[model samples]
Target: MASRLKKKCCTLYEAALEVVTSRYSFYKHDLEMLPDSVLFDVIYEVYEKGGIQPLREAFSRVDIVARLLKITDKRFCLIRSFQGALTSMFWEEVPRGTEEAVLQSQFLVEFGGGVPNSLAKGYENLCADLEDTQVQVDRLVETGLRLGGFLSDAGWFAESERILLACQEIFKWARKEGRIWLQILECCQKLLHVQSSYCHFEEADVTYNASVTTVVGLQGDFVTANLAVLYKEFSALHFNRSEYSLAHYWAVESLRAITTELPPCVIIEVFRQASKACVVKREFKRAALLAREVLCLANEVFDVNDPRYADALMDYGFFLINHDRVRQSVSIYELALDIRLAMFGPMNLHVAIAHEDLAYALYVYEYSSGRFIRAREHADKALFIMEKLLPRNHLLLASVRRVKALILEEIALDNMVHDAGTHILLQNAEELHKSALDLALRTFGERNVQTAKHFGNLGRLYQSMSRFQEAEAMHLKAIAIKENLLGSTDYEVGLSIGHLASLYNYHMKKYRKAEELYHRSLDISLKLFGESYSGLEYDYRGLIHVYHKLGDIEKVAQYTYVLNNWKIQRQLSLIQEDDPLDSVGSPLPIADVAALFFEDDLD
Candidate 1:
């Protein structure tokens, strides 16, 4: 590497490509050589000479390119400069005779890796290479951002602010447009605030609304995926403002609308984000449909082993998980994991996350089947890698620990653990869960959807040990977190009532409390799904138990009337076990139980 840099041919501009390729694509960021000014010079010189397209073509390693551009602040600034430059230059007429036109079709594929200033690696060299300004301000701004790496960590407050403002100027230029430009400009302003992390979500709500109002043109039919993203952003703004009904309506509409005319890639991504929103709403059926569409499209466009294909496959797996298609979910996640490990390698973060998610799914299914060892193995692998990469107090690390603890819980329950493993598992599980809760409360605040999960997990742990008081306290905390985060009528707030009620009835012998929770949960089921839904059976069972405990024959008969009304729903089962409440899967693994629903078909 030293030998390559020492040779001074090709104006050192060529060296920038080498540096980028090595740093992001092939090697780590080398701190050993070059001052900040000197390093920035290389990146600037390269951008000036070759443009952004060429740098992108050089990026065969997708992860490296994305990491260099997205993960690090320095790279993000530089990438933004390139992006701004491209947006500015996109419509500019090339000098008539010097270069051939680069079509938009090639933009997404070969040169897609570049920032605004660049094109595909080799393509720019063929195009007119006319401009060599005395100073590239874009480069200078990028250099300042790179310098921030050293400065911000040291609290060089004034210098960092100045550097950021300089970058913002470039941002403003990039976002400028005539009609489309207005929303683009607004988006740039909001992005600036967000990148600074100075403004809160309240600011995001207001700005995002303004930005969305201007940006909903959805003009082009080509990049339908991009249009879907724009609408998703719009929906997100509504979501931020607590207009959830509007948010859901818009998000579903956006995905449904744009995907009708978009390219396959765009279609898949549209579905991915839409699936996330569906998951948030517990609209599992919609999410599953979108995920399947992604899979089908991926099969047409990408190889079975492609990363994007794996992504689609992974989502399909998770959709299966959420829909109570356990066997299918496990298969999909496994296949995706296999492809990712083959193409990207085992240590990749994407692959690691897949392992974690799949492990959880397996753990859930393990309740009713054999070979949960797959779940334990995958979770352990995820835990090991996260512990190596993340900070000691990172919430993600804590989540990984929680995953490990769950796996251990399964192991303890499955094996004949007389003493040592049981004590260790219980001790570690409690500590890790507490850490996870604390970290979530600190980072996301107490009302985050995540805090409810932490509380739910601890609550279940307590309930398992017959610690009803502790269990009730934890369950209430979970309920409180959700009720505060979402409104009383939101689907999320309804979930806590079931478990908290279960504790009230199951162990505390408090029939009234359990009855109340059952009624509330049933109300949500009736509202969201309708009274004829199969899920209402759980509510019925809970109430039956409550009435049995109370010796209330009249009320029990009244409940029976409702039960009889849904005999078709009861004779069959299709309850989904995916939880907004539990951080982990349920205590009762339902896969085998679910299998009964399809048993006749299979037979």
Candidate 2:
């Protein structure tokens, strides 16, 4: 009986293969006509013994098998057919464009509901009788990771976390098997990456530390590269937490752990993180050097069109912006934007970030009609992308909205200069500022620094519109918030004071009140940055104007002398000709304000 059954199975398999190869057109319906037992045997044998071509041919007709599984109520057949499909697909190289479809199919088979009870039982039995547990574990890990990645990309943080945690467990089991430890470590790193991406920093830190400990415990010299990767992730975690010092330290450690055997991409990433940390710390020269190295290495090691090269360009642009090279920075940002647009198209988040950065730099470079239009265009693109990709109340979306509001305000101010339809621009600016303020209030609350900054911006906008009462109310609200959060002597408080002083000096013509506010602002500026700081020049000039207006000769002389001497000192210090920070008696402006939101150093 056994010999006869074997002969029958062989004959059925040969017939099925022949039909799959020769009658490809009707193979689907033909395969569906076969008995379930014979069909299952054929699929299993083809997946296991047949080479890549036959497996490909078999899977070409897998849809029919899938339909048969749905049509037939045979539980064993359903489970066996699914198992065979999974094996074939797992081993085959998924065609490039069909990744999403393949992943969807795998997800359905693994977790989609409506599996027959007997099929589930048969699957469990198959798992129990399988000799190679490692293969099963690997399949589970692969499926879970792919599903988790899909969820992560779709912004389903909670679902992705659940899948990633499952993958982590399977990886833990694989670790104990004494083989594939490096692959297991790689899996753990991927979990850490997903955790970090979703802002689950605490859990990410735990996973990172655990993975580091595991890699160290393995005591294999071959795993040093993995150790470097863990350190790089640790550095990124610290960077996200705003611990630039620790971030730089770990980044250096990662570079140190890497040898010639490791890929240069890892080294480039370390340098990128290290450069970002240096930028955050205001180590401009070192940051510039490291950024240049990153760009050079990326150009040498990666394709010129690769996103890594664009990332290096973006970082260099940011560094240039920090050093007050706005035009140079804008050009670099344009290059980065072009590369990203070419690589990922216009709607990508990276493209959005490049647009935001370039808009800010253009706005700061000059507030002409041309630059204002360009700035508004870029700001709108950034806002559009953020609206599509992020939740309504996300802090990142709020930040983009704030930048857009600033660009609109700049356009309104530019129109006010020429007296060319200022009302419409001002109204649009006002609306955007209010929307941004609302978002900031919702995301960061009223007492937050971001909320206070929005209030200050709106107050400035109102002052420009000659809405003095509303402007006073907004400015005072901003000052109250800043003082409450950062105390009276903070530089931010000084900014609010100077803005109010400007309102009184230029618009209200209240010289006495303006003089008082200017004095207060001068004191704060003096304390925060000594007399030599450029910000003090604004306070000094404001006080000079206020004292002159008030007909106070002695105070006027004192402030005039101070202003002149500060200018001479600035000359001696060799400050640039067109320093934006040297703007007289105004808030730091949107460019500096935007800097406050970029605390992460990287987009």
Candidate 3:
């Protein structure tokens, strides 16, 4: 009736409302005091006058009548009750005062049915001449679903849930009458999406169970495809709960049932979730392989220049870098940068991110072969973009500045001499490192991972300046923070430990301390990436030097044999690189090579 009143003219209802509000409060008891006959007379007069005005002075102050009617929601459902009043006043003279009772009856009928579907019940009663209720039912379901979606998007979850439940009830009614199977499934999907989004996990679990049951009961071609979609939602449900193993299991199950029926986006999401799960489980090789498949699927499904394809490429590139394929990642990062540049121009945050990633790749590549110029160029570009786009102390700005500083440090070390120009280069590098560290400290405080990273970068810079005591302090801080936050066995903690080891072995001549640190760092690295890690070479050399200084000839010879055997194994692994997606070979210099390359004897 509210919907109908919106479509039709409600001038008389407006006049009555004006008259009632001016005389009495909007309370139900106050509105009930006005006589039915007198109110009807006033409405009729207003209708006759073309909805001009309603004056309470036209009636006597003491006019009262039967109190059979009740008010709800602090106002009259004016048009609905007024319609009955008009019918009795005009045409039903014998039943002159019967309209008020009819109004009350209609209200009771609607109140019994429920809120969203109450009007639909009224429609059924009014359209009793139409025998088919199916058309009305279909319209109700369609309108309710659309409204539910709109309300959900607007963050009105309660209203959306009510409307969807009404739609579900309609479907249930239809099912009892032996109709509608797929429609029920579709409604369940929509309802469960909303339930999951709002973290109504218990309700979503029930909906999920009902959807699975519906799927089992369904008789269709490729029912398993629908089952796969359900499985995908289940995976997401568990993923949100931080149950990675269950999420991965369901994701794999969904992948197995993949067909042309499933959307391309769903397929990509399944692979992405599986890959993320593998990463959380520390199955890096498997994660990289799955990430490669996501890139392949995205390349085939999306346009080459699409942002989604670029995003997939970026993910694949990051995984490749993590799994020790930095050279390939450089090209991947280049492609992502090109796409973002074309899509959003050069000044976008995405473009800056791509530059930052490419810069990191080139920086890591320096230890393998050396690309200092290209790496510095990308790092500077990233810094320039970030400085323009971000606030002065933004975390991203701090990160790009750190990368540029590291690049400068590398270049300065490469041009080592007792010359004025080299001193200026070192000075610039130190300033950038200090600025990055200050920004990190201000933005994330002292205990954050980013702050720890900045601390480690300063340690490397100070060590280059031959400030061994300062470098030791900085490395110790980084190690303490990383060990507290990321655990002692984290890859980052190992890097910090190794940096301190390098500082002791190469600069301070603290052979015993250097030996202990190198061994501890090696133990951490072996636990993280195992025996074939290429970065272990740096630790081996440090141990060899330490043992030589300590006059332990047996220990020195043992490390030499180990280092030589490691080099031969690395050579054989490079020869065995058969697949582009294979990330399980001898580990290359994993990220942050500066931590491992303090000495020129690394090669």
Which model scores highest in TM-score? Answer: 2
| Cα lDDT tens digits for candidate 3, 1-603 | 899878746677677665654443333344445566445544434434433123212111111211112121211222222222222222232355554534433332333113323333333333333334888776656655555554353233444566677677666546343436656776776777667645566778888888888887767563565656667677766654445567668766766666655666666766666666556445675675567667666766777866667777787777767665667788889988897665544444556778989998889877655449889888877776566544566555777788888887877778767567777887888888888789666644787666887899899889998888999999999999988876777777888999999999999998888888898999977776666677889999999999998899999999999999988876676576544444333322212222232223432
Ranking by TM-score: 2, 1, 3
In model 2, the worst 10-residue window by lDDT is: 580-589
TM per candidate: 0.58, 0.59, 0.54
lDDT of 2 by residue, 171-266 (tens): 543547555676567767666766765556668878887787777778758577777777777777776644556877876676566665666776
Which portions of model 1 miss their true places by more than 4 Å?
1-227, 233-262, 369-371, 410-416, 487-491, 522-603
Looking at model 3, residue 373 earns an lDDT score of 88
* TM-score of candidate 1 versus the correct structure, residues matched by position: 0.58
RMSD of 2: 14.6
Superposed by TM-score, candidate 3 places the C-alpha of residue 146 at a distance from the truth, in angstroms, of: 17
**C-alpha local distance difference test of each model:** 0.56, 0.64, 0.64
